[model samples]
Target: MAKELSVEDAEKKARELLDRRIASVRTLVTARQRLAELREQVADADREDVRLYNAALNDGWSPDELRKLGLSEPEKKARTRRRAAAKKTAADAPGVDHQEPAPVPAPEPS
Candidate 1:
């Protein structure tokens, strides 16, 4: 079997490696934040573009004319939403009776 690192040793080694990777790690974090900001701006821009196109169409601008003017139609991004699962109640569950049935009595000897 391969040698395993102890908890303390692992943490120590991890800390040591972090010194080499700290700059790259910081860069990754900054890139992620920048990407998020850009995505928000893109969404806002898409909404604005669609609004402008519709308003222009209402103002008698043709589709051909809009296309010739270098405007591209927005491709919408699909967002997935998660819903919370409903909790089951004891009464709603099967084979879970709240009240007990009456007991049966034995017959006497003749």
Candidate 2:
């Protein structure tokens, strides 16, 4: 014979499950934030490595030596046509202020 649960007991069981689910969601949010922080730290480390490599090169380090140290110049990024078009459109949009100053015209040669 199966026992029938009272309404109060059923409500308590439901509340417990809801509490567990809320806790799991909170844990998930915390884990996601930690992952984002870790990614940023990795990006910062990459930038530091590039800066150090540039400094070493400027100090007369040979490319071969740099390669031996597992260092290389950062690759130039090539923009796709779609991205270029979007960028140009954005730049040409009204009320958009570009950070770069307008080009100064060179003085006429004497």
Candidate 3:
């Protein structure tokens, strides 16, 4: 026959389980944060590579050589869209006339 645990012993076991649960939750939170940081680092690296490729192009690097770096088409498209959005935002500045004027009709040529 097993002996029943005393109240004090039961309380201690409950506290221990609670502590373990708290530690597990903390570990899980830390792991999630680290994963997010790693993902951000990867994105930053990709942007850096794109910037470097642009610089090399300006410095007369061959397109074939740049292509060898494994930049995918989707990545290029995303970069293009990002650049266009940035330019649009900049052009839509406060107090600036954003609307284009109608094209002036040229005088009829003889």
TM-score of each: 0.48, 0.59, 0.55
lDDT, each prediction: 0.86, 0.86, 0.81
| lDDT: worst 10-residue window of model 2 | 79-88
Per-residue accuracy of model 2 over 1-110 as CA lDDT, tens digit each: 89999999999999999999999999999999999999999878877877887899899998789888887676544656654444557788789986899899999999
Which parts of model 1 have CA positions greater than 4 angstroms off?
1-16, 68-72, 77-110
Pick the winner on TM-score between candidates 2 and 3. Answer: 2
**In candidate 1, what are the lDDT values of residues 32-103, reduced to their tens digit?**
999999999988998998888889989998878888988655566688888888898987699988677888
lDDT (10s digit) by residue, model 3, range 1-110: 99999999999999999999999999999999999999999989878878877888899867776667764322653334334444557668888888889999999999
Clashes of 2: 0
Position 12, candidate 1: lDDT: 91
Candidate 3 stretches with Cα past 4 Å from truth are 1-4, 68-74, 77-110
